[model samples]
Target: MPLEKIKVIAFDADDTLWVNETFFRKAEEEFCALLEEYLPKEEANKLLFDVEMQNLPLYGYGIKPFTLSLIEAAIKISNGNMTIDLVQRLIEKGKAMLQEPIELIDGIDETLRRLSEKYRLVMATKGDLLDQERKLINSGLENYFHHIEIVSDKTEKQYKKLVKHLDITENEFLMVGNSLKSDILPVLNIGAHAFHIPFHTTWAHEMIDDKIDHPNFRSFAKASELLQIL
Candidate 1:
């Protein structure tokens, strides 16, 4: 259960390695304000969340899906009276999100630099494959990882497959990320160690209320703290 056995240290992309959810939040605010005439700001925001949840299967996760959901929510709220120009504006919002700068979290570079020297670093992230790749390239951290996995989703099955691909046992893997749902629970469930490095902002869909009490589970306030644990 200690760091002594961790051979491969995997990290989640989005909010873990760089700024992600904050851009989504800003887009959501802009979207709600854009549709304020059709519905109240709060109502518009709630409807967007509903549409996003419903479309998760069809569109999966990323800016493209989010943009489509925003459009669908706008049309439904406006009773099919949403203007083409407004829809165009929404599309532009998604483009802006995709184009946003990849700001690495504070201390991420140093932590990754130090950890890569001691452990085999892997980048395990989920999003549109192209978008994820673009962000990785822009982040300038691609060289830090020995293996890069851009998965569609994160689950016990996915993590198991990752371990198999890495030629490592579950006990030798350690996952660190901001999302409990995608990063922590799945890895821990698969008998691997997990660390929760929570970001200030998270997506509504990724929220969880239960506390993780497993022996292999640990929490840190920031990436720098991992140095002490490692």
Candidate 2:
């Protein structure tokens, strides 16, 4: 199906607009190294991932929750023998991640600029609201989006609600993001068009092994290629 009917173009913020998963990957490496004395690097990584999955319900997603998970994992891995200095290093790592400069993906600014001219551009991202807002402001690309949504989660229900809130029919909305699980499947399931732009690094939680075939689903190697489809 052509995108002629798409009136609103929603973009995912993290890996789609700028660098995100890379920072998380780096943090995880640092965390693993910190706990290497207690457990093997591979084991430390597995334990941290488990802790993160468990804390998702209570802490949700973002650097802060991830930091907490790291601390928790450290304590558990070390049998409550974690040193104060190590805990402080973990905290500092999270802070550094939060303060990392917003690095826009190559051609993101130009792509968003071109799309904003023809469609009602909006940012649809899931994370801490304040952090999302801060990144948007610092990015200097916020003006391109007519509206922004920092959602708790991206489910079919959330997508449906968003369309209703935007007063647009499902067919009139198009979502673009890097994750097949969060950004593509949910939007397509809701009867909206979706474009998947794969980032170099992805969180394991967002990985999907099965193939997805739908008239409204498309994939691109990079965000700049969106211009060709739109």
Candidate 3:
């Protein structure tokens, strides 16, 4: 498998195109602080992540689900003794996050601008549909993408569907993103090419420990680096 076969290049949203995980991390710190009396910051953070994983099937991903998880975790951490005021604050926190301005990743705009000229670019990511769309519009990179594929989760099956929908074979698709778990591994498993451009922060649920050594997989430190090889 070489670069010449790649016909469609799909990019992950959130941390891949712009800033995302940092807000979640900051909110988590604040969340733990708000619940400091009930649990230490480290323990509270772990509990929150556990609650999120448990709720994923029901709620999917986004600020709304995260907000709900915050409330649920808060109640559980406080033995169901948390006040309504605390819940209100969590609600407000989620609203603030949804309204936060988009910050493009360094070199991402240039990378996208350049790549769009050579390939059929698509934004293939998983998250709450409305929120992801909002970010895409605000990101100002929407025009560069020929198609947008937003799913509840990124998996081998989903990747296969995307390739079919694009009227391309698995070997003709290339996925670029920050998370190895959601963005890199599954795409590669589907016999597609994948490039990992890791962000500084990653959600606990998206973390993985395995070393990747696939022939179709490559890792880079920044978005611009894609130009050198692509």
Candidate 4:
């Protein structure tokens, strides 16, 4: 069905807007290499992923925990070879990931520009507040959004809160995002519409198990196609 009358167009940050996952992947590769002295590359990767999956609730999402995971993995594989210097380096890498602004996903600006003209574009994302804000500002896409939300988690409550704050109802709102947990599920749960634009890599912390059967649950093959519906 065509979303011919969309009013509030919301978005998820990170990979939805830019090349975020690739950085994490690169860091993960470097992280695995760091542990090669004690564990084979395959085993190091498996264990690191295992630890990340196990630490979601405790650490939540974003570079902080991913960095912590690297630190923990390095310590575990030290075999008496891990030193304070290595630990410091791991911390610095983590800080750099958050501090540095990666490139925006290709075609994001043109797509946002086209959509913004006809809808009340808003940013709806969850993460470290300051970090997410910095990414948006540095992205050079902040001006397009009239409202911005930096949430701790994505839930029906948060979706409704945006609706209430924006003075729009389910029919007028459309949440476009990459994560099923943070992007698609919550907004769709609140009787609102959503565009599920899948990313290549999804962080384990953002995983959610939910039934996706709704009239408003839309799917897209690319970010550029998002403008077609609006």
List the candidate 1 regions with Cα displacement exceeding 4 Å: none
Local distance difference test values of all predictions, in order = 0.93, 0.94, 0.95, 0.83
Q: What is the C-alpha RMSD of each candidate to the true structure, in Å?
A: 0.7, 0.7, 0.8, 2.3
Stretches of candidate 4 off by over 4 Å are 79-81, 207-211
Give one digit per residue, the lDDT tens place, for model 2 in 1-230.
Answer: 87899999999999999999999999999888989999999999999999999999899989999999999999999999999999999999999999999999999999999999999999999999989999999999999999999988899999999999899999999999999999999999889999998999889999999999999998998888999868
Residues 1-230, model 1: lDDT tens digits: 76798899999999899999998898889988988888999999999899999999888899999999989999999999988999999989888889998999999999999999999999999989999999999999999999999888999999999999999999999999999999999898999999999999988789999988999999999999999979
Task: Give the winner by lDDT: 1 or 4.
Answer: 1
Candidate 3 local Cα displacement, residue 38, angstroms:
1.5
Candidate 3 whole-model C-alpha lDDT, 0 to 1 = 0.95
> Which pairs of residues have clashing backbones in candidate 1?
none
Model 3 lDDT per residue over 101-175, tens place: 999999999999999999999999999999999999999999999999999999999999999999999999999
219 Cα displacement, candidate 3 (Å): 0.4
Clashes found in each candidate (C-alpha, N, C closer than 3 A):
0, 0, 0, 1
User: What would the per-residue lDDT of candidate 4 be over residues 1-230, giving only the tens digit for each residue?
Assistant: 44765688998888899878888888888877877878988888777888877777788667887888887777666755798888888898998898775698878899999888888899988777877888898999999999999877788988898899999778788988889887887777788888888888877656777668888887887899876656
In TM-score terms, candidate 2 sits at 0.99
Best by lDDT: 3
